[model samples]
Target chain A: MLRNISVEINGKRILDNVSFEPNRGINVILGPNGSGKTTLLRVIIGMVKKTEGKVSLKGKISYVPAEFFSAQMKVSDVMLAGSRIELNEYTKVMKKMEIQGLINRDFSTLSSGEKRLVLIVKSLVEGDVVLMDEPLGNLDLANRAKVLRILKEYDKTFIITSHEIEVLDFASKVLLLKNGKVLYSGNPADVNESLLSELYNVKLRRGKDGWSNFRFDF
Target chain B: MKGINLIFLSLLIISFFLSLVYGQVYVPFDKIFSLHGVYKTVILDIKFPTTLSTLLIGICLSISGAIMQLLLRNPLMDPYISGTASGGAFGAVLAYYLLAFNLPFSWIIYISPVIAFMFSLIATGLTVLIGRKTGVYGIIVGGVVISYIFSSLITVMITEMSIRFPQVPPLIFWLLGSIQIVGYTDVVILSLLALGLVLVSLRYSRKIDLVSISDEMAYSKRIDPNKFRVFWIALVSVIVGYVVSQVGIIGFIGIIVPHILRRFYGGNTKSLILGSITLGSTILLFSNLIADGSLGFEIPITAITSLIASPIIIYVLVRRNAQEY
Candidate 1:
């Protein structure tokens, strides 16, 4: 239960007067670029100190950073790190993520999508209260769907930040952040396309398939 | 597993005997059977104790370097980099200048190392306390600052003491490190200390491995980085304190020996600890031999090692820079 966190960086307020109560499901944070998404994740994991508010949480909190591949290590080595899961469990997770082939490869040698899958699996093997920063980025559609399926099956509290509209489908609650402030907090289905388009000042044209034009408006 | 361990054990024995044999005056193997009175005394009293001290110092310093590098997660790190050697030097110099009561020879020899060890440990404690707020960089900076302060004090003490004592030149030679014969009692004590350190290091091998990955990763594993770091800093201080007390400031073995072994053995602590002990002992023995035997001059053991290690350090820097760009 991570809550009541406020963080500021370089004299700029990144998370301003924010309070969150997370239940046992995926809570997705949807925001545009520079919306304090990564900063909030860092604060939650106690990586970056909170300047103005307290971040209180119980149990283990595992964070999968966006640049996980920046470390020079073997893929299997990184997966085994900080995770108490058995080797068989790790291998099972790798197979489920469709990355069993990457087990022996160097992490730096893996493709971006493959590295993202490995990082996600590593975090999953750790204890509950998983906080991921853009877990689906650089992943292809198939791998993204595989990860979403795993997230749905796992019984743990998850707070994830992503800009992809497809990821919001898995969110039990979507917190809309604008300019480092919470603009809307409710169920994902309640966030109408027009409101999301209006929040970023972009035109939302509804097509037969879905809403398009993801580029933020000026 | 047994076979590998046996090989190292045999190598240690051979190296010990070779270290005793290869010195300024070669003691012939046949002379052991002849048993000349003075020859037996020279071999037993002088060369044997010196050989044992070299082995102990080598094992202690190398293990200290390996553990410090793992804790800091920086390849270039060593025990001396954190000001332990300078602090020890300061204590030794202070005792010489302030407490020149013309005590017994045994008192001067034994008490100096203990005083030096205590001073280095205090400096280590202070560094860890002040650096807690600033993180890793703070520790590095604090170490450098403390090193400078202690080094200045040593210089002042040396200048004042030299006027009164005519044997101050030999003391300076001792400061630069020499593998001259130590007493049998000192050898036994140093060996016991080294054995204790190796056991403690093995117990914490897993934690050391986790630290090498990254600090945040260690914390996520429920190992508080600060607490573990403090423990490691103390362990390293004791190792450095003991070795520097025995052999003054033998540079490069602590830094280069571990890295060179890491190239063959991976970064795992189990292999690293073992390899460092073997390789470090061999290098020290060889260096001491060159300083005393073939060189035919009273060359400082530290000078010989620096001559070998400086080029390797430069090569590592250039290679790292090339990789970075």
Candidate 2:
């Protein structure tokens, strides 16, 4: 479990006085763009140092950044970095991800969806507290569903950030963030249309088939 | 293949013999085996040490270059490019002039390199620290600044030294670099230092690869990027410092060797390290042979490497540009 995280950037509070205890399930930081989602994730994994709180966690943690093109290394090479896994196991993981063809391909050469899959597989193979920044970004519906299935089956603590409602369907809880503050933090089933509409300042209309779209006045 | 290894071994042996033979006065091959006279003394005392030193220096510079490239994650990073060599050169020149260190020196030779190595480490440390706060462009810019600072200091020292000591001109030529005669002690010190560095480098090659990907990625893996970066910069400084003190400045081996090896071996640090050492030593040996053999007067080894490397570098740049177009 990772807990007690507060973060600030350039002396302005971002994750101001925020603390949470993450259990063994999917916890999604449901927030709009630029709502301190990435910053909270960064603080959790010790990438960005927290200002006033300490992060106490057991076991290792793997963080997948929103932008993963930080290295020019090959797919397999980056995944097997500093681990004791053999070559065949690495190949097996790649094959399972259907990214076997991209094993030798440079990280810079992969498509956005393919890179996302690689990062997901990397986090899964390590089997730890996986913190991902928008893991579903740029992924098609099929790939997104495939990744969500994998995350559900892994049975580890998953902290993910995404704006897609379909991606958040499997999330046990959605922490609705607005203006860097958590307005609603509870079961996704309890988050109704009125609360979400007020949080995002948009009229969220629910349709007959359980699909909803937000209508915003510019 | 084992055959290739054997071939490299044979070439190394042949180069060693040829290096001993082709010096100021050519010792006849037939009389090379004789047990008596100046030929034996020259071979045992002078040529042997020079050849060994050349081999060790080549290995050191090349491995250092490979490490620097991986550490900086910059394709263009070299000892000269990062200003380590220039810093060492300044230290040597300072030792020659300011300290009035005499020729055919003993502990002073080691002392000069140690000083230069420390200075280069500090310079590179500062670069990495600033670059971490800023970015890659910042490191490159900082490298340029450090290089200019060391270059001007070298120039000032050279001018001042020339006025005080007439033999300082030859010392300046040494700073330009050559395959001049060195004692066995020099060869041994350099070989030991290079061996130690290579061992440490091999151990940290994986961490180096992590850093190459992204500092943040490395941090996520529980490896402190700052500590690893500082370690690598210090390692490169020591290797560069030792070479510059022993043999002045030999360029391009560090830069070109790693680049060429990368073409064949990909970016796996283990393979890259091995390939750089072998290829670097071969190139240095071949360049030294050309410097010693082709012309009546021995040219500086740096000139030979530059002459060979410039055209190839231009060719690569042109090919890349053409592809872009």
DockQ for all candidate structures vs. native: 0.25, 0.43
lDDT of 2 by residue, B67-95 (tens): 77777766556777677887777776666
Q: Is the docking of candidate 1 incorrect, acceptable, medium or high quality?
A: acceptable
Q: Give the residue spans of candidate 2 off by over 4 A.
A: A1-4, A68-73, A163-165, A192-218, B1-18, B23-36, B97-107, B129-134, B167-175, B311-325
Residue B38 Cα positional deviation in candidate 2, in Å, after optimal superposition:
3.5
Candidate 2, A70: how far from true, in Å?
5.7
lDDT of 1 by residue, B1-325 (tens): 4665566567776777677667787777677556678878877888878887888788877888777666665455566666777777676666565347866544656667777878887876766565666654577688768777877776677777778875543455535677776459868887887888888877766666656665545655667766787777776666676666666667667777777765555455666678767777877887888887755666788788878777766776675566456
Give the Å shift of residue B195 in candidate 1: 2.7
RMSD of each: 4.6, 3.5
B-chain TM-score, candidate 1: 0.85
Best by TM-score: 2
Candidate 1: segments with Cα more than 4 A from true spot: A6-17, A23-25, A30-60, A65-88, A95-120, A133-153, A161-166, A176-182, A192-213, B1-14, B30-36, B101-111, B118-153, B166-175
Q: List the residue pairs that clash in candidate 2.
A: none
